[model samples]
Target: MLALRARRLFDGQEMRHDQVVIVKDGRIADVTADVATDVPAAVDLGDATLLPGLIDCHVHLAFDAGHDVVAMLEPPGLPDRMRQAARQHLAAGVTTVRDLGDRDYLALGLGLGLDGPEVLSAGPPITTPGGHCWFLGGEAAGEQGVRKAVRERAARGVHVIKMMVTGGEMTPGTHSHLLQYGLAELKAAADEAHAHGLPITGHVHCAQGIAHVLDAGFDSIEHCSFFTEDSYAVDHTVVAQLAAADVVVSLTVGVAPSPVPLPPRIQQRMAGMREALRAIQAAGVDFVIGTDAGIGPPKPHGVLPYGAEMLVENGYAPLDVLRAITSAAARVCRVGERKGRIAPGFDADLLAVAGDPLSDITALRRPLAVYRMGSRATGRVGQINQTAPTIG
Candidate 1:
């Protein structure tokens, strides 16, 4: 058994000071304020706070963050690039990531071993014929086609089903504000995924697409931006319906400052995007952050901290942000039992930062150390500040 003492602990829900977490055989054995003398050894993490390893609900390890990811999809050394990206996420303290889109089921074959984050893959997202991301090779035209697509993914061992209910800006011929599949096709996809005991998530935008997603009974919605033909709008009525239905909204969050210029359309509509996000928060909808990592330069695989920090900066409670990334995110990913909390009977995956995050949210940016499977894994990339070594 290994005992780790920390100044404070955020056990995925509440904060407690002067705690010791015990690990045995790669699982949390116990957590207590009083350290037991029976523990053979202890590692004292001075002046640091321990937190559950973070989970980013949406990522695409196959898409290296760059100016033109679509063009680079099938480039040389693609497998090597994916392995590197997964490790980058691990080094940033994200121990689990749900890959919402990938080509040829490459993420499942990465073979990064224990050092990489736990990957829950979607293989390839279900899209309409020649619709958004159809280039990824998941184009289904009719209701039967959508059902077949979901069954194929289930057979491929995908953890969840991802469907594009609307077009996306990333694809040249597709419009983000327009529906890609009608209600019947969507319902077929959802019913098929449910029959196989899987959750279905829809990529939707605009009020009409959101309503269609609800009508089809999808378990979760992604990128609920409420976009229109030429502008953006926050549909409070649809938002209320979503909240009333108790559906989870996986908000695509996070961006890094880059010298490379953003696309003109996105750059112009950023203000409106922020406004919609604020309104969504006010509606009190269930939410979890999905960094949509690896899509471009602004969304590198390690960008989850920036997303959490962004939410806290925008009038969100730090505790809520913490829960969103930890326990809440794990729940949405269907790994709630083993992945999120720092409690006994849970996986021994934890992150230690140099200071209390409740006071300054940026503390998460400075990970002093990371533990995975009861082992001291390395995470030496994030920003850090030194402090006197002391223990209570």
Candidate 2:
């Protein structure tokens, strides 16, 4: 049992002041207003705000965030690197992450310790021959082949099914604007995934591909950026349709402050991407932070917090950005009941920042303490403990 008292607390949806969160085992027992207490065991986080540890809806543990991502995922010691990546996320206060792409079902095999973030694994994304991310060995084609692929993931105990509806910049000979699978094949994959009672997300970069994912009844859409051959375009009609549909958009946002230039295709169209995102938000479309971490040099595994921060920088309200990363993200990843909120019966994964994050979002970058499963996993306390959390 543990009693954690903080000056302020963001309960994943709202803010509260002077609260004490009681934890038993690995779940939050209760939360109440702080008062004079004889309970001497409380860990008082002075002048700090506690919130639920964040969740990232999409990430790729297989690909190390580097210039040569394809070359990085070679067979030797891949699992160890993935474990380190998962811990890096946990150390940075990300308690949950959905691995959307990986090679050879390796993400599921990594035994990230209890101190590590909970990983929702998608073994390998289903893609067409030579399609987006075809190098991960998830290439499939035709209705029958896609269905078989879905079944294979289900049998392997994957948490969700990922399909590449359009080509992506990562794969050679594949354009971000082109659709890889036809409607029939997409529907077949979605249907098969649903039959196994799994939610499926589509990796789509073009406007038409987003519509196709919605029409095929997929649970969510990834990278719905409406990219074209040369520049990007945001179709208002499609954005409105997505708003009306029972689907969520896993917006891949954020980049590390690096001198490296982004891929040519993305760099050219980067100016218009923010406008497209705002248009989607203006249409009342639901959103969750994906970050597409580990795909390149700018998207390291623990960079999800920067995604929320970037949204705020790009005109999104700070509160909304916080919600998108916490509660909304958990909902998209299908872990809403257990993760995100710091309420009773929820997982006791919490992050404590030195200052109120609601006021200064960058405070998240300076975590004072991170608790996983009701125990303090790591913390930085004054000049005595300035060490960053090491990979567990």
lDDT of 2 by residue, 1-392 (tens): 78899999999899999999988888998898753355556898989999999898998988777677788776498889888778778877888989999999988878776757899998889998878888889989899999999999999999999999988888889888989998899999999999999999999989899888888999999989888888888899999999999999999997876556688778888888988888987888889889898887778878877888888787787888889989988888888998899999999999888887778888877888888888776532211111222222
Candidate 1 segments exceeding 4 Å error: 383-392
Q: Candidate 2: worst 10 consecutive residues by lDDT? A: 382-391
Which residues of candidate 2, in runs, are more than 4 Å off? 35-40, 379-392
- TM for candidate 1 is 0.95
Clashing pairs in 1: none
Q: What digit string (tens of lDDT, one per residue) describes model 1 on residues 1-392?
A: 89999998999999999999999999999998777888898989999999999999999998878767777786688888888788888888888999999999888888876778889999889998889998888999899999999999999999999999999989989999899998999999999999999999999977899999899989889988878787777888988897898589998888766555667777777778788778778888888999998887778887888899888877778998899999999999999999899999999988889999999988888888887788777646562111111212
lDDT of each: 0.86, 0.85
- Note each model's CA RMSD in angstroms: 5.7, 3.7
